[model samples]
Target: MFTRTLLCVSLSAAAMPLMADTVWMKNGDRLTGTIRLLDGGKLLLETDYGGSIPLSWSKIATLQSDHELLVKENQITGERAKSLLASDEGKVTLANGDTPKTVELASIKQIMKPKPFVEDFLWKGNVDVAMDYKRAESDTDDYDVDLKTQARHGKWRHNATVDYNRELRNDVVSTDNWGTEYALDRFLDEQWFWQGRLEYKRDKIEDLARERTVGTGPGYQFWDNELGALSVAGLLNRTDYEYADGEKDNFYAISMRWDYNRYLVGKTFELFSTGEVGKPLASVADYSLDAEIGLRYKVTDWASLNMKASKDQVSGSDGDKDETRYTVGFGVGW
Candidate 1:
């Protein structure tokens, strides 16, 4: 009797259908696993036999999800629904139980897995650090570090960035600088947004001790595609400055910021440029400009090599000069 019972249980378990997801390749290969994320022209899959595998978007012929997903089409913003594979040749079924909407595989922009409401609001951060040294004649050392974090919930997004740099000469600290910026953006629609930001920094070499700025304005997303993106915003800002010589002043200014990014080598490499200009209402000649250009080469599924050059310029009562800085750092993102 015991033998019979064991056999019955084993048969039931074996007869149970698999709940795992599936992916079909253009070459007629079938992968059975859980679909993790589809981003940057690549699809991630977690399998029982092999570990996580990244399949190029061009190679994926069909996608079948075991759970609901938030999908974005080339024309539509965001929709939540179930999906199936192989229902058609070059389309995916919406599976809404009504008139199924067939979306062209090429028109699908992004796919996100569903998570708990609170988990969607959790922050994700990336950090990079680099150092340099010169040992002949005059000893000098330089350091650069940056940390950035962002979170998205519904139509609102929050971002924070912090960076610090220092130079040492003969074991003494010569240049010490650090800054942090916090920004909040609320999306009004597909291409427009309202933005606010606060920033603080200090420079010792420019006869400047500390600077604080607060700004907010409207912004626009000109184009966002698989290849590149561009965004520009204008802000009304109030800046306060304190120098090492015990002089302090504040001014109202107009500021403009722009950022551009392009993906090269099909997500393996990235090129980016960003800049900001500010002019004080008291005097137009007294202005500030900050700009940076950088490239990041993806090394793994989560890490990259980063290199950047930036120029900081200010001509005002407290300082008048330009500082150029270069850095090479290793960064990781999630």
Candidate 2:
């Protein structure tokens, strides 16, 4: 009889009973319950009216149920009915004539978002062996040893950077420079943001000068949590400088930035302040100011340890100068 009708359709597909998967994590979050056991590594979901939700499984990555169960039992019963209507005996309800109360359960406040950046999309670069001490004015004491490398990626969301430098100047062991920058960002509502950047530079002791810059901007992200976001941005820049002696210069600049992110011991801390101002294209010449301060430390998700202290002062020309640079670094892919 067709082998007993294929053994009664394989025992009715093994007596049907299976549908539970949807856990996805690593920071983007999504759940659907029904694990019931995993132990040490965590995971005990069961959730479908019959609650129970213990998680962790290395912050899950995947687990998609065959047909159901992946977090949606009426959105966990509307978050347990909005935590029992924000409790206080669920605001006691029993108006007149009859009594039927059993709604207590409110003490709400569970908000999550912002995790999963375990180095999300980063590809760092580093190399620095320093010993530079110089006393200028007539140049007498000088020391050198400088090499650089840099690479960065998203979670800046979009970024690109390149750098290079070889030491020893006044004593003329010449050659020092390389620079590149590319950036693009967009996030319009969660505060507001929009950005664009493009830069290029080549400096071989100043005279071989080559520079280019383009910028666009608008940013204002009052603040965002999980320890990051506090912004201010405004930019408009255009510059071109080419000189091998046959001089040429064109300028226009205006910039600003103030940004920060937090986390202490485990690392991850960033702070920033920036400024720029320059103007002169046709004449009516006069305006220049530049500033900076930056810091970063993140041991790993990829790798990081950075420090920066900078200053550049220039105004009107003549005898105007002020400069300082200090950097300690390490960084790698995310």
Candidate 3:
């Protein structure tokens, strides 16, 4: 009985690799794992023993997958394959029911698991929190919470963001503000889209008690892939401002907005920036800018350490305003 059980255990261990995706390297190394995706010259493999490993695409001799995947070739459209079959060096075959198409590995631009038909949307987002405390002649405490999320389904995409900030000095509230924004994009083609957005901001301790904005414009997507994305938009905005002293003003403005992010070193670090600058057509304010630049270091697949600098300025409001802040925080991303 002991001999029979040992034989069964050994056979099971040997059969595990046969059930998973396998890659043959140019240096004659064999690896078995689940192929997560291939992008930005890196093929990501999820392994039981080594978590996720990124392999250089050029160094792969051949590969085969047991599951279906979407493969894009030469920056063109993508096709769904039932499986991948290893061919000669630098070649792979997409296996369908009865027709297997062989192609050069160098011609493949991207490979990703397809989302289920019932749930055809991709969702991603991040939440960040930062706090500051100082003990001196006067005690100070500061807190900030930022949240951003987006979902994409076919030609439609939705984005939402929320921010809250508070500061206290000597047990007295010094700064308290919160803001929220929502935007929707409808893609006309691969790179062009139209966007409509609404934003609202409120401050409890400033003369600018309330602000509202509605904007719509055309945007261009430069590129969006596993590595990073960049996009820009031009907008015509209608804005309303209400002051704590019972003063109100409305203006029409033309503005530009941009969002950019890039990942480096196998996605271990990310550098990002996003902001909007606008010139109000009316005299309520000459120009306004709100922007933030940040860096994130991935601590794990979902956790990160982040540092950010933000600036908010208005040239010709009731009182000229300029504020800058720096924060170190932790965040989670998906």
TM-scores for all candidates: the values are 0.72, 0.27, 0.77
Write one digit per residue (lDDT tens) for candidate 3, span 179-238: 999999998888899999999988888788888999999999987866688999999999
Q: Please report how far candidate 3 places residue 24 from its true position, in Å.
A: 3.5
Residue pairs clashing, model 1: none
The parts of candidate 3 lying over 4 Å away from their true place are 1-20, 25-29, 36-43, 48-50, 55-62, 65-119
Estimate, for each residue in 1-334, the C-alpha lDDT of model 2 and write its tens digit.
4325334533553487644444545464556654433333455555676455656555554343332111212212212111110112112121222442333212111212222322345443333333445667643322222222223233344545555545565566554666666767565556666878787766666553676779788877675443344666777777676766766766676766544444332224455454455554434225545444556665544455666665544444332334455656554433
What range of 10 consecutive residues in model 3 has the weakest lDDT sum? 1-10
List, in order, the clash count of every candidate structure: 0, 11, 0
When summed lDDT is taken over every stretch of 10 residues in candidate 2, the lowest stretch is: 78-87
Error of 1 at 172 (Å): 5.3
Candidate 3, residue 32: the lDDT equals: 86
Off by over 4 Å in 2: 1-219, 233-255, 260-273, 276-287, 298-306, 327-334
**Cα lDDT listed for each candidate:** 0.75, 0.47, 0.87
The ten-residue window of minimal lDDT in model 1 covers: 1-10
Best by TM-score: 3
